[model samples]
Target: MSVIIKAAPLELMIIGGAALGAYIIANPMKVIKAGFKMSIKAMTAKGPQKQDYVELLQMMFQLFQAFRKEGPQGIEKHIEEPDKSDIFKAYPSFMHNHHAVHFLCDTMKITLSAEMSPYDVDDLLDADIKAIHHEEHMAVHAVQTVADGFPGLGIVAAVLGIVKTMAHLTDGVEKIGALVASALVGTMLGVFGAYGLIGPTATKMGADIDAEGRYLGCIKAAMVALQRGAPPIVCVEYARRSIMPEERPSFEEVDKATKEIKKAA
Candidate 1:
């Protein structure tokens, strides 16, 4: 039992370090550290909220509405200087996320460039969002791969322990019991690593990535609808409704936000 308690935690550090050290030796330490940091962030960041997205859609609606009523010239005031844009300035968190910022700005720029169908722009932007997510997925995949291998290597550790115990097969009953117990520890460690820690963490990161995908999709829908010349209220509605139902706001919630946006503008 003592063997079980002591070796179990070490199984992760030992197996994980081995896998990571192998990978790190092949990749640059800087890149590995960045991947490590993102993995940690993935673990911590609870992800965007229903409220965050609702506000985002509200702000997007305000922006799109102004464009429809005032034309591209209307948004130029805000886009040229988003820091001062009364709408964007209000949602500083959304503004600070570079990916979200670039996604919003690039789509608007494409729309402003000429007579482009918003639907086509929406499809292209969706593709872009997918590409960004796919790249992030690679990092996720690597960490998961390491996690997957840990349990198997832990079994290998257990097997080695059993082999060591066999060499003492003649040590009599008490020693044999201790040896057998120690050998079984490796197996316990393997199973624990598989189910308790690494697997859950990998699954969590995947969920995080999936949630982020939805948020970006919301951005795409709102901007595309705006490009198609929808009302700001209607465009925001498009964005808000695109959210997965769990993350979606009530119609009344969106309505209130849209109303306030209008009152403010």
Candidate 2:
């Protein structure tokens, strides 16, 4: 079966152009930029991969150990300027993530101050995670909004097609039927765009956002455990257990890696 619809382009343009304009109107420049980036990244990535989570946990374990051995002063340099720090440099994947770096460093900065109680630290980290997720959710909401409007936009396209078809009524039944079919293509395109493309993407973006939040949550769990005076290894274990099972490293694997980190130190 040959596949082609001549009027699809024009109909799609009407629906797509209006949807894009509405998206711009509904969101700020920052969100638009983030949405674009998130959509592109989602095509290749499904949130934090297994290796990413492994590196994250390893980095946290190492950082905690440094704090244990050298105290606040020794750990200060790494937390303050992580880009220049040798410790952070060792884990390129974790270091490359600005969010993870900032989250780890900032929390360490507060912990080293020796002011906040364990409860207080937990509360602070919880608040920060919530705030970060809230900002990220805005981009997801923007995409979902466009998806929700797509069906109506399709209907608008179909209606416009019908109007054009009306002007050509004297062109004979065969001609009128072709024009009506072209008009119906608009509805098909709109629904397809909404459900087939934009809707699924929005859902994936939301999942990515949630995954990143859970990554941060793992760090928070470890930090809180550290504040409670748990041993460094135990603290990291706490963090590791917080990870989604699929991403969580095996107990033996983490134990062996932590031992190697200690050996190298």
Candidate 3:
């Protein structure tokens, strides 16, 4: 216990400091900032829950209804400044997701302003989704790289401890044993950090990134359906089908939600 207590700070400083330095060296400033932000988000953010998706579909249904009823101009005000739009403001959960908001609004803007076919819209949304995924995953990759290096960094700490131990060999067996034990702490910490903490955190961040991507994909599906002239409810149904079954709201649930919106309208 004494050996570990004495050795832990230095061991952590060595492993953690080196790992952070390596991360900074490997990524650009944007990615470095994003990695830090994403790491924090991984710990705190819940990603998109089922209710969030329900809100998303409901929001889209309302927007599509406006577009269908009053034409492109009817929906323009809402898409142009969603924060001020009563329709957007009604779904606070959907509004809070900036990525989804921009994804849906930007596609709608292009579709309304231009004459792109559904195929072109699909390609455009695909490219946008891929770009976002790539940018976000860069941070995930950075974190995973740091996680992968932890074990190796721990080994380096152990070797430093061993070197320190060599100098104390002439002191006494007890002292030498303590020094050696202290040295081994580095290896233990590194392996534990890599496998027990950092690695899992990176995996979580990756999963969250994927979840966000899926959310955007849902929007893309709806947008494409809208371009193809599917009804408001049908557009959201297309989005619902794109969701993973585990998180998907049922058809009846979506149908009922849209009905309520119609009633409110």
* Poorest 10 consecutive residues by lDDT, candidate 1: 26-35
lDDT of 3: 0.92
Candidate 1 lDDT over residue span 1-265, tens digit each = 5766765665556556666676576555554664576678776788889888877887787777777789888898787777788879888678866678878877787778867876689778979988888777766766677667777777777676777788888889998787777666766666676688766777787787788788888988877777776777777778888998888998899998888877876
Task: Evaluate all candidate structures by whole-model CA lDDT and list the values in order.
Answer: 0.76, 0.87, 0.92
Give per-residue lDDT, candidate 1, residue 44: 79
Ranking by lDDT: 3, 2, 1
| Highest lDDT model number | 3
Off by over 4 Å in 1: 8-13, 25-35, 80-86, 166-172
- lDDT of candidate 3 over 1-265, digit per residue (tens): 8788899999999999999999999999999999999899998888898999999999889888888899988999999999999999999988888888898888888888889999999999999989998998999899999999999999999999999888887899989988889999999999999999888888999999899999999998999998998988788989999999999999988889989998999
The TM-score of predicted model 2 comes to 0.95
Model 2 poorest ten-residue lDDT run: 1-10
Winner on TM-score (1 vs 2)? 2
Better of 1 and 3 by lDDT: 3
